[model samples]
Target: MKKTPLFAALLGLFGSVVVPIYAQTVSLQPLWESDTTLRTPESVLYYPAQKALYVACINGRPTAENKGSFIAKVGLDGKVIKLRFTENLNSTKGMGILGDKLYVTEMAQVAEISLSTGKVVNRYSIPEAKFLNDIAIDTRKNIIYVTDMGSNRVWSLTNGKAELVVEGAPLQNPNGLLFDNNQVLIGNGDGSLLAVDPATKNVKTLGKVTGGIDGITALGRQAYMVSEWGGKVWHVRADGTTELKLDTTAEKINSADIDYNSDAKVLYVPTFNHNTVKALSLK
Candidate 1:
C-alpha cells in the first residue's frame, strides 16, 4: 500500500503515529478585544492587583530569520502596554506566575523572569526534549509539569531537574498545561482536553475541544482553554461540560492564555494571530 504524503509527514512528526481515531465537537464565543498592537500572541496571564493581562507574543517562527519574542500588558479597556522585551526566547508558548516570578517556556527551555524588570533571571534547560511547549506549576506540590510536542510526553521538574513522568501516552501535539488540585489538564493541538494523573501517568478523556488547543488556565472549578484555529476561548468544567465563553474568529485569535480577576470580574485573552489582546469582563 502506498502511504499518502501527508500521512508520511505526520509519521515523521510523531514517530510511527496513527491518525486521529476519534474527534469531539466544540462551540465557542468572543468575550472582548485589544483592537490594536499584538503580534502573534501566544498566552495571557491576568494580574488582578494591577488589573492587567500580560500577553506573550511570538515574534518570529522558530527557524525564521528574526530571533525575538516579547511580552505585553494590556488593560481591560484595550490599552496596550508593551512590557520589557524577552530578548532571546525561542518558540515561546505558555506563561505562568509564581509569586513575583514569571516563568515562560520556549522550545526546550524554561525562562524565568523578574516581573518588575522582565529581565531573564535564569534559564532552566530540559534534557531529552524534542519540542517543549506549555508549562503548569503545582504550587501545592512545588512541582512543574511541561509537555513535549515532539515526543507526546509530559515531564516533571522539581528544584530544576526534569524527569519523564508520563511516557508512551495518547497525547497528540500536547501544548498547554494546567495543574489544579491533584490533577493535570493537558490541551492538545488536535482539539482535545485530557486529564492526567502526574503520580500515575494515567489519563482520562475530559472533553473534546475545537481548534488547536494552545494554552489553558484554571480558575475556581472551571478550566479555560484557548484554541489557535477555532479562534475562540472556551470554559470547561472539570466534569467535562463546556461553554463558548468568547469568540474571536473575526479577530484571528490564535493561541491564547487567561488571567482571571475574580474581584474585577474580567478575563484577559491574548490573540496571537491578531497581535493584540482582548479583555473580557466576566460581568
Candidate 2:
C-alpha cells in the first residue's frame, strides 16, 4: 500500500507518534444532551432490543452520584431519561449491549445491567485490571473483551471471570475496541489501529491516526473513529487508508460511535463533548 501524506503529517503532529485526525463535516449537529448536572459524557451505545441509547458520564471529580457513576437512556428522537446507577461504578467509560443484557466497564469492574429494568443485575470484579476503559463482546464465545488502560493489557471474560489474554504489551492507552469477523480491532488513544488474533491473542498495527482517539465503531466495510482531543471523526477503510467522515469544529465533538440503520441507510453517532447524537443519511 502507498503511504499517505496524512500519515507523515500525523507522525509530525504527535512527535514520533500517530496523531488522530478530526473529522470535518459542516452538517454535524447536536441530537441530545443530559438535563442532569453531569458535564463530561464519555461513552454511548444503542440498545436495539430496547430501542434506547445508553450514555455513560463522569463528573471528573469524586461526587456522590458520580462515585456510583451513572448511565442514562435517550430515545431515538432525542428524549433523555436518567437511568439507575450501578453500585461501585466510578469513572464509567465505554458501554456495549449483547443479547438482552447491557454491559459497562469502570475502573476495574465490568457490570451487567438488565435491559428491561435498567437495573444492575451483576458485577464482575477484574482483579488484575487497573483501569478498564472499554469492552467488546464475542457473542459466539459468550466472552467480553476489556481494555486495561492503566496496566496496558487486554483481558477476556467469561461468566464474569476474567483471564489475561494479552499482557504488558505495546497496546499503550488502548481504549476503543470492536470484534470484526474473528479478529479484534482495537483503537489506541495514541493514534494507531490494531488487528488482534483471538486465538493466538496477537496484535498487529493496522494503521496510524493523528489525533487522540477515544471511541470506534465499525460499519459494514468501513470504521468510524472519534478524535477526543482533535475534535473529529474519521472513516477508515479495510485497506488502512482513512478520510474525514465528520467534523465538529463548530460543536467541539469528542468521543463517538456509529451505527448504521441498514434499512434506512442512516448512520447514528453519539458524540461526547457536545453531548448529543447525530445521524447521516446515506442515500
Candidate 3:
C-alpha cells in the first residue's frame, strides 16, 4: 500500500487534467443569429418539444402604453417562422412554459398562452404589480414566480391568484428568475444574484455585484451564466466567484433575458434594442 513516485506523478497528471474542466474560463461563440422580426425582443424561450424558439418582444418602452408588444416564433436554424404568434401584448418581457401553456409577463399582468393553438387563453392581473420582468415556474409545486422590478417585489401565482411573496432591497429590482430543485434563484437589476427559499423567503447571495442583470441560466450543477442589460454575460460559480464571459456593450448588443438548451450547450439571448435573437455555443 506504499505510494510510489510513478503513482504520485500519475495522480498529479490526472489532477492537472481534471481541475481545468471546472476552473478554466470559456468564452461563447456565435453559432447563428435569427432574423430581426422580433421587435424589441426581451426574452427567449426554447421549446424542446416543438423544436422552436419563442421570443417576447417588448416592442416599445416597458410601459402599459406599449401595446405593440408580441411574441415571435423562430426555428432553431435562425429562420423566422412566425413574426407575431401572439400579438398585441403590453410590453411583454420574461416567459416560462409549463405543460402546454406558455406564461409571459406583460406590464402588471401575466398572460397564459396555449402552445398548441397559439392563443392567449387567460390573463391574471396583479393588483400592485409594476414592471413585471422575468418569470420562473416551480413545476412540482405548480407555482409561478414573477419579478416586478419597478415595485421591487417578487410575485407568486398559484391556483389562479397572484400574491406578493417578497419585496424590498434584498431583491434589488429582481429581473431574472430560475426554479432549481425546490429553491428559486434570482438575478437583480442592480447586479446581485441570490437564491431564495420559496416557502420561507430566506435569501442567500450567490455572486458578487456585476452589471445590471437581465437573465440567468444554469451552466451546470454548480455554476450559472448571467446576462446583463448592459450587454455583458458573466459566469458565476457555486462558491460566489464570477468571471466575464462575453462583452458587447461597445457594439451595443443589449443582452436582455436569455434561455439555454442544456442538452445542446447552446445559449439564446434576446437583444432588446437590436430586435433579434442570437444563439451562441458554450462549447
Candidate 4:
C-alpha cells in the first residue's frame, strides 16, 4: 500500500505490535460529485454484481404518504446511467440486496425490487414501525435486519414475517446497519458502533464516535468507515479507536448513508440536503 510520510510511520509500528494497526490516518481526496439531480439522496449502495451504484433518493419529505421517492443507477466512474431505475417508492432510506431482489426501507415498510427489471415485486410492511432507517442482510438464512430509529429498535424479517431483534437503551436511535462476519453491526444514535450476536443477542461496543451514526460499512476485517448524519465521516478500527476522516458540517452538507467502492478505493457519500453524491478516493 502506498502511504504518505505520516502513515508510513504508523504502519511501521504494525510489524512489532501484536494488535493489528490499520491505516488510521486515511486521507480523502475529492474525485467526483454528481450533478444536483439526486434530491435528498439518503443512501448509496455499491452493487458489485452490476458494476454500478444504486442510490436511494428521498425526493420529498422522509415520511409516509410520500411515494415520490425513487432509486437511481450511477456508473462506477460517477456518471448517471439511469436516473430512475426504480420509482414509486415511499421515503426510501437504506437499501440491501438479497439474490435478485433489492430491498429498500420505505419509512414503515420494506419494498423488494427486482434488480434485473427495476420493478417493485413485493412490499413488506411493519405496522408497528415508526421510522425504519437502514437495512442489513444475513445471507446465510436470508434474514433482513432493519433499524427503526424513531422507536429505537431493530427488527429482522424472514420468510415474510418480521421479528424484533433488539430494542431500547442499548440501541439508542439505531440508524446504519451492516451484516459482517456473522454479526449485525449497528451504528447507534448515541454514537456507538455495536455488534450483536443473533443467537444470544449479546451486544458489544466496538467503538464510539462524536455524533449520531448514519452509515456503517467495513473497509476490511480490522477497519470500518462510519458517517454521522451531520457530515462527519470516521475511520473506526477493530480496537475501538476512531479517527475523523471527513467533515462538512460547517458547509451544511450532510452525509446520510455512504457506500465504498473498494476496487476503486472511493467512498460514495450521499449528501442529503445538498442533493449530490460525492465520491472521495482513499489516498
Could you say which candidate leads in TM-score? 3
Model 2 Cα lDDT, one tens digit per residue, 87-204: 3467778777777788888776888988777777888888766678888888888889888877877788888778877765567778777777678777786788787897988788
Query: Candidate 4 residues 166-242, lDDT tens each?
Result: 88879898999999889999999889999999889999999999988999988886578999999999999877889
The better candidate by TM-score, 1 or 2, is 1
The 10 consecutive residues of candidate 3 with the worst lDDT sum are 15-24
| Model 1: residue 18 alpha-carbon error in angstroms | 45
Say which prediction, candidate 1 or candidate 3, comes out ahead on TM-score. Answer: 3
Q: Ranking under lDDT, best-scoring first?
A: 4, 3, 1, 2
Report the error of model 3 at residue 1, Å. 23
Q: Which ten residues in a row have the lowest lDDT in candidate 4?
A: 15-24
**Sliding window of 10 residues with minimal summed lDDT for model 2:** 18-27
| Model 2 / residue 162 / CA error / Å | 0.5
Q: What are the lDDT figures for the candidates, one per model?
A: 0.70, 0.67, 0.87, 0.91
**lDDT (0-100) at residue 29 of candidate 4?**
93
Per-model TM against the reference:
0.79, 0.78, 0.93, 0.92
lDDT of 3 by residue, 96-183 (tens): 9988899999998899999877899999998787788999999888899999888888889997798878888687878999988578
For candidate 4, give the lDDT of residue 248: 95
Sort all candidates by TM-score, best to worst: 3, 4, 1, 2
Q: lDDT per residue, candidate 1, 1-283, as tens digits?
A: 4779997898889888642322223333346677555667777777666666767777756432334777776766677765544665676767777777778777778888888888889888888777777778888777888888778888877887888877665788787788865888888767788888887778887777676677666555444444444566776655676676666577555546555666756666665666666655653
